[model samples]
Target: MEILPRPFDAQPLDGTSTVPKHVQLRESLRSYIVRSGEPGAAIPSERLLGEYFGVARMTVRQAVDCLVAEEVLERVVGLGTFVARAKVDLHMKMTSYTEEMIRRGMVPDARVLSFEQQGASPLVARELQIEIGQPVVRFRRQLLADGEPMSVDENFIPAHRVVGILDDPPPTSLYSVLSEKYGLVMEWGEDTIEATAASPSIARLLNVEMNAPLLKIQRHAYVARAMIDYSVSYYRADRYKLWVPLQRPGVRSPRAYSSKRLG
Candidate 1:
């Protein structure tokens, strides 16, 4: 990995500036990363940065900490901080993980952690629009892309939706199985995303540090008008991002309406 060169000739932090010193330092570091650093390149030590900028070591640390939280930098215990790799952006669309990875030219895989039939709790029942304590097939799996752990998915489906799903092993993409085997096509889905901290088990599974940032996604999938499954997936925040396209309300594309309508 190429080591990022320090910007020794940069102007010192202005004392009269209203912005906090740490924020100024952070912006400088961010620019340096963009211009000079590559993924895994080591950043300058806090002590060295402090001396270079004539600031307290704590101030340097604070700036570095913010970058770490943003995943622009990562710190190894024995090694110093280094630039982070780019994250994968998942556009807001109704697609299976397998399909998405393939679209990105990545090979996708899944390891089934556990699979069982159980009585649904109130939350699961409500999400699947079934009676409380109804029979449900619970499937837990870990998703990987190019052999790197990506996310953990836990899904609950009403027992009647896909009969004999539990008889065989779970596939990497549940949607594919539902479509091919049961003829139950997932036509649409709704998702909610939030930032969260990794749990101990999640950290271990994903090979990340405990309490590291994670992206939590909750989804409800439907076939026609019937709810089919409810799922929650925890994705590594440093490795993944959610993206969506927005359009102003009351705006319509020219193709959406015929030109004859104007006449």
Candidate 2:
């Protein structure tokens, strides 16, 4: 494996330049990281960086802090900072995780953490449009991409909708099983996404530290008017990002706007 360049080998920041010292250092470090092209590669300590750059340790920290906030580098407790993996951009769409991962040319897999037939909680019942305390099939799964843990998902379905799911082995793709065996195809879904800290159990399953940043998503998948699946998923913020496209309404081209104004 190619090695990371030493801090002294990096170009010294120009004091006469108009750019801030921290910003200059940040760009220099970013260039080195990109050139290395190695995820999880550990750069030099702040002390070494400060000494080599003839700056204070505080200055070195400022540059590192900026990269950390941008997810370009990650600090591990007692382990130092390492280059972060690029985040997966998930387009806001109506598709299963399996389908999305496959389309991205990554191997997708799921491990059933727990499966049970239990009474639906008020939240689950409301989301599924079923009676409170009704029996529901609950499945907790760990979703993986390229053999790495990506998210933890808890799903609930009304027991009457798919009677024999408990008897059959837990499925890697719940949507596939629902569509093929029960004829319940998910036509649409409503998603609520938010930023949250990882709980202890969630942290363990996703292999992240407790209180780490995570993306929490609650979804209601429906087959026409009937709600089929109610699920809550927690994804690692470092590894996943939601992508959305926006268009401004009633916008006209520059030439059209000019012509309209003249007319």
Each candidate structure's TM-score, on Cα atoms with residue i matched to residue i, is 0.71, 0.78
Among these predicted structures, which one has the highest lDDT? Answer: 2
Per-residue lDDT of candidate 1, residues 1-263 (tens digit): 43325544444678799999999999988887887788878887887788888899999999999999999998888888999987899786778899999999999998999899999999898888889999999999989998999999999989988788888877768888998999988889899899999999999988889998999999998888888889999999878878876667999756557765866
Error of 2 at 103 (Å): 2.3
Predicted structure with the largest TM-score when compared to the true one: 2
What are the Cα lDDT values of the candidates? 0.87, 0.88
Report residue 125 deviation for candidate 1 (angstroms): 1.5
